[model samples]
Target: MGEVLWENIIVSILAFAILYFLLNKYAFGKLFAIMEQRRELVVSQLDEASKTREQAHVYVEEQKQALNQARQEAHEIIERSKQTSNKQAEQILELAKEEADRIKVDAVREIESEKTKAVAELRGEIGSVSVKIAEKLIEREVKNDQAQEELVDQYLKEVGGRS
Candidate 1:
């Protein structure tokens, strides 16, 4: 019985050793190579993903800067337009004032001319009436022409002084 048990244990041990040796020689190296390749591939993919995330962050920052610049330009344009409009309004007011002053000066000159014309016309009418009255008085008094001329001159002088 002891011999039979011993033979059985020895045979089992030999079978396990043969199986372990065969697997190590044929499959272990290939399996380890495949696992190493998978590990390298995973590491490269993680590095690419990190680079892409950094690029995305840079692109977002650039867009924000561009947007801020555009806003500043728009504000500048609005301010310039306001300044131009104010200048135009001031110019228009200045022109209107000049025109008003010119019109007032013209009116004053026209009024003075009209007053001079009226005064001249009144003087002429008064002179004709005085001459007619002197002629009537001379016919009644039998006066000489020289005496009549002297009286008329004196009367005209008195009227001129009063005016």
Candidate 2:
């Protein structure tokens, strides 16, 4: 039994040493290299994710700037349109005022011309009536010059009152 025990111990120790050496030289190196490669892949993927996040942030900022610029341009366009409309309205108002003034002046001139024509016609009628009255008085027999003059004055007064 003692001899068997010694043999068993020696054999177990030798086997353990040999196994440790073999794993250290071959399997352990390959396993560690594979683990390192996996770690590097994880790190590179993390870096790529960070870069993509930054690019997305930049894109969002650019979109915001573009939206702001478009808003400003739209505001300017609306303001310009308002100004143009106001200017047009002013021009139309001015033209209307000018036309009204022209019409009023023409009406006043026409009224003056008609009034002048009416006055001239009245004067001509008065002259003809006076001439006819004088002819009638001359045809009638008169007693005295003073009486005829008085009758002529009275008739002239009556005609002037009627007119």
Candidate 3:
């Protein structure tokens, strides 16, 4: 019975070695190759994902720069408009002032002309009154020189006072 037990033990050990050798040569090699292929696929996918993430970041940055540039251009346009509006306002004010000055000059000229005309008419009336007075005195024919002189002095005084 002891010898049979020892023999059974040896046989079992031999069977385990053959099975391990066969699995290492055929089944384990294929299994390991499959595992290596899966690892390489996962690494390539991770690299692709990283590259895509970097591209997305660059796109976001470019959009932000474009937005900032657009805002700056809009601000410049508004500033230009304001400057143009101010220039127009100043030009209008200057034109108005010039017009007012021209009107004032015209009014002064008109007043001066009217004054000159009035003075000439007054002089003509004075001349006509002097002629009529001389004709009346000649018709009266005052004989005394002293009386004529006194009458002339009195008329001169009256004319001066009226003027």
Candidate 4:
């Protein structure tokens, strides 16, 4: 009975040791390798996500720079248009001023010509009136005394010569 009990205990211990060795060599080792591979895959995915995020940020910055450049170009075009418009306005104003000056000069010339014509006409009218008055006075005096006409003509001739 003692030998049989001892033999049974030894067999139980041997079975436990064999089970432990099989689990460590096959099940536990393969499970641990699978877990390590999954961890590495997750780390690689995180690294790829970080790289994609950085690329997205850089793209956004480039777009912003392009937008700013476009805005600046638009502003420059507007300023150039304003400058051109101002220059055109100045040219138009100068042309108007020149036209006005030309009109003024023409008007002054016309007025001066009219004034000269009026003075010459007035002088002719005054001379005709004086001649008429002198002729009427001489006619009146000559009818009264025909002998005095010869002496009056000689005296008038001498006065005209002096003037």
TM-score per model over all chains: 0.64, 0.71, 0.64, 0.62
**Per-residue lDDT for 5-113 in model 3, tens only?**
8787889999989998999999999999999999999999999999999999999999999999999999999999999999999999999999999999999999999
lDDT of residue 7 for candidate 4 = 83
Candidate 3: residue pairs that collide:
none
Q: Compose the digit string of candidate 1's lDDT tens values, residues 1-163.
A: 4356878788999998898888788888888899999999999999999999999999999999999999999999999999999999999999999999999999999999998987897788778768776676866684578876877787778677756
**Rank order (by TM-score, best first):** 2, 1, 3, 4
User: Which candidate number would show the highest lDDT if scored against the true structure?
Assistant: 2
**Runs of candidate 1 exceeding 4 Å displacement:** 1-26, 132-163
User: What's the distance in Å from true for residue 18, model 3?
Assistant: 6.5
Better of 1 and 2 by TM-score: 2
Estimate candidate 2's RMSD in Å.
Answer: 4.2
Give the range of the ten consecutive residues with the poorest summed lDDT in model 4: 154-163
Error of 1 at 106 (Å): 2.2
Candidate 3 displacement at residue 136 in angstroms: 4.6
Better of 2 and 4 by lDDT: 2
What's model 2's lDDT at 110? 100
lDDT of 4 at 77: 100
